[model samples]
Target: MMRLSRKAWNNVVIISMLLMIFFFNGLHKKLNTQPVEEGVQALLPEQSFILAMAFPELKIERIGTSWRSQSQQETTWQGNEQQLEQLVELWQHQKLTIANLPVSKISQTSADYVASVWLAGEQLPAVYQLYNIDQQYYLLDKRLQRVFELEQADAAKLFPLYPF
Candidate 1:
């Protein structure tokens, strides 16, 4: 029978302990880590949103599950409840990705429209600008360079025509 030397035995024990530690650490991280969803971190209240547009300088607010808009003519327009909810949901779940270009590189001078969203009881709104680059629609944050790509149809929903 052959026996390992004391030094060899100690080395073996140490290496085994290290392997166990690494294995358990990886398992712990895998089990504890949660998947993050891509979207705005802000928690939107139920059936509430305030949408403000730049081109037309229009402001719309959700009042008691219904949407009301103030047009350029200084008239109030009532919005469809279901349509409003759908629009709000689209914005709420819209997944955002990091923009390849920085804010300085992107030119906002040719931007056709800008929109901002504010939740109920919130003083500040999340601002976004809509731009068409090479016929592709891009939605970008005013303060941040993060951008979201969407089809033209989806982008059009952000600027719904109000019934006055």
Candidate 2:
């Protein structure tokens, strides 16, 4: 067996510890923001803007907190990550990037906004709901009449889900 001096042993131990910490930190950091559970791209502009309305700062700040709060609130009413993932997919497909959507106006102290956006070359109406603390946006499926609740839409059937 090879023997090492005390100084060399200490140096090796310190280097190994430092390397371990760096490797673990990088690995965990990426996992923390894992791409919205697959099949969901980045938020589009109009949708991002609309979503931003749910946050008091308009998605400019505290976005993570807002998202978490929104998830909790919706989940309390039977919403789940599946629905949120589907919604995110739809938003990505809609070609709505955050940069293209801007808050037209904030109506009073409420989180909703009057925003101008172009869809198929026409202006549209978009509404955003803020979490209780004005942190995150609660994305509702208006067609289903559910606010913040997530449910898979039926293709061949017509049924509406409502949020309480």
Candidate 3:
């Protein structure tokens, strides 16, 4: 059997111990690093809304429109019954089935005319709502998925379907 001398063995043991010490020291330095707040500040932001509004370049797609009652005492945005029926019929002709048609569901403050109908081949069906309190028409933005209160002035500019 080939044997290592005592001095050679000692040298080998010393080299292994030094390597072990070096690895442990490196591990200790990593564990003892200062608090992570410095590294994290760049990742997390302090403000979100200001960032959205200030950067007008960031396009915000309209999700829907809100209608307000012409008169404060009116309580609801009233539309001609016949006109509403025709609107529904027009949508039906386009192959969209509306649920809860011609029904008024009253809320605490206002009444909502809601129709669940699908648009084209989209999996998420769009909601058609006529709010009685505001007595106006709103188009829910399918992309943003939120209803916007429609302004009579901005109505024409927002949706081409109904020009006011």
Candidate 4:
């Protein structure tokens, strides 16, 4: 058997501990992050940055790092900067699932509110139809032919301009 001095043993233990820390750190990061699942996509594609979002009653646009929000019903700015920025952040990170509800689940009575987003590099703005049915919220992307279901809180965050 190889014999080691006390000093050598201490150094070896520290080296092994460091290797373990590094290994576990890498492993933790890999485990903590969720794997991308099929049929799940970001609300806004990361490649394109959003320049503005115009809902039925309000419009918010990026003015450098800050944002400008104004009422569509009127020309006055209604919401504060912090709220507008949070709305932008939510749109940037929120993920949407491809809705699989049956046709019968959603009736025809739900009134649709339109939300338009102007993205960077796209000449035409992307438009989404928002709906609230039985307190559940949905955003439909007509171009993609997909409906994304959202929770009530998230729906409120997306369309705070409205009374909903």
Candidate 5:
């Protein structure tokens, strides 16, 4: 039997312990790190001057904390400023990722809608397409890359209809 010397065994144990510590440290970091969307800057909710959503049947807009909707309804629907602000904040801080599928190839359905966020002085708005495919809602950037997964209920809140 080729038995290792006591000193040799001690060295092996120390090396094993060091490797285990490193592995755990790496795992801890991986678990704790926030999932941030790469290649995109965080959108500032506070700096947003206008928000709009366009659908095949109607259009909704929020300007300076006031909400208006143009549809077949006789009265324009108004929204709560506090709720709208919170929604903006939620979108600003939500974690997103680069889509695995290309935006051009994303299958669109009849329920899809286009949303835009405009900064204080920007001539063009940052556009996103919200799609409901197979019951899951996805938010795709203007370039057609899927950026965020959203709940259907939350998406509905963006275009609430006021009961006449």
Candidate 6:
């Protein structure tokens, strides 16, 4: 029988382990990765302005050219009409990256918040659910069942009053 030195035996064991790893790696099934859709897609439909936004904490309504917020605690928001208008505009025209499937298919779990927005000319308000998965923000439209992945800054822009 041919005998090998201690160093040679160690090298052989290491090489064998490396070969096994490479073999298993090659045989492993690859994850089906969907290409990210890149674009500035509008968060809300065009020409749609929120006439009213109802959250668990507060309800904001459009009064004439301005807006007002009344809290559930029977308190009112201190922000003026300009701030309300800016909030409306952010909802109206904010662009976000639409979260693609299988994330959309998988992330239909419980939401942190569910809010309703009454848009102009719409009798029924559109419902939206906000979710946080792995520290990333996602907004799901209950009506359309579409999920839009939001950036950290965009989430802040959309919900300035709400605590996350």
Q: Enumerate residue pairs that collide in model 1.
A: none
Per-residue lDDT of model 6, residues 1-164, tens digit only = 76999999999999999999988776663434333345556767787877899878778898887899887764334567788788887788878777864445535578887778998888888988788888888888776666788877877677765565
TM-score-wise, the better of 2 and 4 is 4
- Measured on C-alpha atoms, candidate 6 has an lDDT of 0.76
Each candidate's TM vs. the true structure?
A: 0.55, 0.27, 0.22, 0.65, 0.47, 0.67
Identify the leading candidate in terms of lDDT: 4
TM-score of 6: 0.67
List per-prediction Cα lDDT, in the order shown.
0.62, 0.35, 0.37, 0.77, 0.58, 0.76
Q: Which stretches of candidate 3 lie over 4 Å from their true place?
A: 1-89, 92-111, 134-164
List model 1 lDDT by residue over 1-164, tens digit each.
65999999999999999999999999999999755445533323345545532325566566665666565555343356576667667766555444455566556456667777875566777677777777877777764346666567767766554221
User: Which ranges of candidate 2 are over 4 A from the true structure?
Assistant: 36-164
Error of 3 at 38 (Å): 42
User: Distance from true position, residue 16, model 1, in Å?
Assistant: 43
Model 6 regions more than 4 Å off: 1-39, 74-77, 102-108
Model 2 Cα lDDT, one tens digit per residue, 32-101: 8644322322333333333321222112112442332242132223324454344434543442112111
Candidate 3 C-alpha error for residue 129, in Å: 1.8
Q: How close is candidate 3 to the true structure, as a TM-score?
A: 0.22
Instruction: Write model 3 residue lDDT over 53-142, tens digit each, in one string.
Output: 001111111123321112223223233445434433343332211222223222233323334443434565444443433455443323
Question: Across residues 1-164, which tens digit of lDDT does each residue of candidate 5 receive?
Answer: 76999999999999999999999999999999867546544434344555664444455567655655555445344445565555555555554444455555565444366656654576776676766666776677663344555566656654344121
Any idea what lDDT model 2 has?
0.35
TM-score comparison, 1 vs 4, better candidate:
4
Per-residue error for 3 in candidate 2, Å, reads 1.0
User: What ranking of all candidate models by lDDT puts the best one first?
Assistant: 4, 6, 1, 5, 3, 2
In model 5, residue pairs whose N, Cα or C atoms come closer than 3 Å (at least 3 residues apart or on different chains), thus clashing, are 103-144
Ranking by TM-score: 6, 4, 1, 5, 2, 3
Candidate 4 segments whose C-alpha is farther than 4 A from its true place = 1-39, 74-77, 102-111
Instruction: State each candidate's clash count.
Output: 0, 11, 13, 0, 1, 0
